[model samples]
Target: MGDLSGRTALVTGASRGIGRAIAERLAADGARVAVHYGGNEAAAKETVAAIGEERAFAVRADLSTPDAVDTLFARLDEEFDGLDILVNNAAIATSSDFENTTSEEFERIFTVNVQAPFFITQRALSRLRDGGRIVNISSGVTRIAMPEIITYSMTKGALDTFSRTLAQQLGPRGITVNTVAPGIIDTDVNASWLRGNPEAEAAAAARAALGRVGRPEDVADVVAFIASDDARWITADWIDVTGGSDL
Candidate 1:
């Protein structure tokens, strides 16, 4: 664990899956976390309870909406005197064949995956203390370009670029931004495939050098490193957390 006793962090998509794991990881390191969830208030509260209310709080914000982001930060500011870590982990996607992919579907994924993180960082900059860390959750699909989830891959690819560029822009401010791209993970988002479809899960697992699907904690560990002082020299870099699948 790193020394983060006085730091405060905001983690989006914290109601479940990788986001919840990241929030827990940060809290374990002693940072007070604002657990942001788009839906499922009960699940979000459960995350806070697991991490302890003294170290984590449940916050709700619909990232797909333009105005709700600012509203989210406004509440975060009211709770923490200064924000030290900003984790843009909130994202959404739907499975569809290329011909079946609709403009609405693509737009929805991009809005929440790309636009939300960009704007949320912009909106929350005022509260991000100097030397703070901003870690964006990306996907291995950007590198492997998964065929089934093409649109989702596109959104994550954009995030990799945004992480690099934003790091340069925030360099002068002493804030560092980086992206952590994870491979197929065993989470509720993927529970159907892992639980009911053994054949599908095995095929997915074969792609990873680890010989298994990733766990939420696997990705969370990488995010924690990027947010740590050990990575102070790293900026504008996209660190792959995909269990050697990209290789």
Candidate 2:
């Protein structure tokens, strides 16, 4: 754990999955975490309870709406004196190929996955303390093509570019910006098809050199490192947390 006793962090989509793990890890490291959730207030409260209510709080805002994204930060401003870490982990995935995808589906995914983060970071800059950190959650789909999730891959590709450019822009402010890309993970997102089905799970695991699907904690640990002082010199890079998948 890094020395983050006095730091304050906002973790979007922190009510479940990788986001939940990241929020919990940050709190465990001593940073007061703001667990943001779009609709699951109960789940968000559960995360706060796990972190200790005194050290964590839950905030709600629909990231798909631009106005709601603004409202999220406004609420954060009221609770925190200043922001030290911003984790843009909230995203929506669409399982559709070129022929099957619809315009509305693509727009919805991009709105939440790409547009929200861009605006959130822009608004957060004024409140972000110098020497702070920004971590964006990306995916391995950008590197290994998955036609079923083509739109999802495109959103992450745009996010990767955002991270690199933001790192350059924030360098003068002493803030480090980076992206963490994860491969197949045994999260709720894949539980339907990746769990229970031993054959399917095995095939997914075989894609990684480690011969296993990842856990939320696996990616969370990497985010923790990037947010620490040890990674002060590392910025504008994609930290692949894929267990060497497709490599």
Candidate 3:
């Protein structure tokens, strides 16, 4: 049996991209996974199918809504008795720069990327088992200067702070709260600019010390390990899954 054979994990935004990869990896490790999606029911179902219907289920909640956390956990309560891992991976980004970013855009980004995760975890605490895991998916932009997505980077920074502080408070319960920051990965989100554009892809690859752009699975594997029993002592840490980008 896998180390997480009996565990149950909730991976937000598991409908696509890095979230989907994390959900698949967790399921492979023998955890029953709740594949949470913002609005894409089809993609969420595809994720479940990929992981096997028996091992995964889809839950939908538009995290931009104020009651999103309640809606999410209400659905979750119907499926699992308790949660062993919570992966806060749902987020949205805007390309608007500092000067162009409007109040509405900033609010929307913060609402989905920061507020949703915060409240979701707050509600999850009671359902989370004592020795549970909380993995917040952050971004390398928080470390590297990306002026184009300055607002997005700010949200990640807030998430990183949340992870560290929450880790300290939840230590007594044996709950580990940490953040995983990923560099550029070749996902659909980056497809418009990075996929067919050979020059752009090459430039992104060169930034990494590994001389290659990261894949969703690259970050997923690290998260799988962090969620396992092997990483019980690891908490409140920001683990970089950037493939040594800009290092």
TM-score of each: 0.96, 0.98, 0.98
- The CA root-mean-square deviation of candidate 1, after full C-alpha superposition on the true structure, stands at 1.2
Those runs of model 3 whose alpha carbons end farther than 4 Å from true positions after fitting are: none
Model 2: how far is 36 from its true place, Å? Answer: 0.7
Q: What is the lDDT of residue 219 in candidate 1?
A: 90
Please, what are the lDDT tens digits per residue for candidate 2 over residues 1-247?
8878899999999999999999999888889999999998989988999999889999999988768767897889899989999999999955589889999999999999999999999889988999999999999999998988899999999999999999999999899999999999898888899899999999999999999999999999999988888899999999899999999
User: lDDT of each model, Cα atoms only?
Assistant: 0.88, 0.93, 0.94
For 188-220, candidate 3 gives per-residue lDDT tens digits of 899999998999999999999999999999999
Best by lDDT: 3
Q: Which prediction has more favorable lDDT, 2 or 3?
A: 3
Kindly provide the TM-score of model 1 when superposed on the true structure, using C-alpha atoms. Answer: 0.96
Ranking under lDDT, best-scoring first? 3, 2, 1
RMSD to the true structure for each prediction, in A, is 1.2, 0.8, 1.0
Task: Give the distance in Å from residue 227's predicted Cα in candidate 1 to where it truly belongs.
Answer: 0.7
lDDT of 1: 0.88
Relative to the true structure, candidate 2 reaches a TM of: 0.98
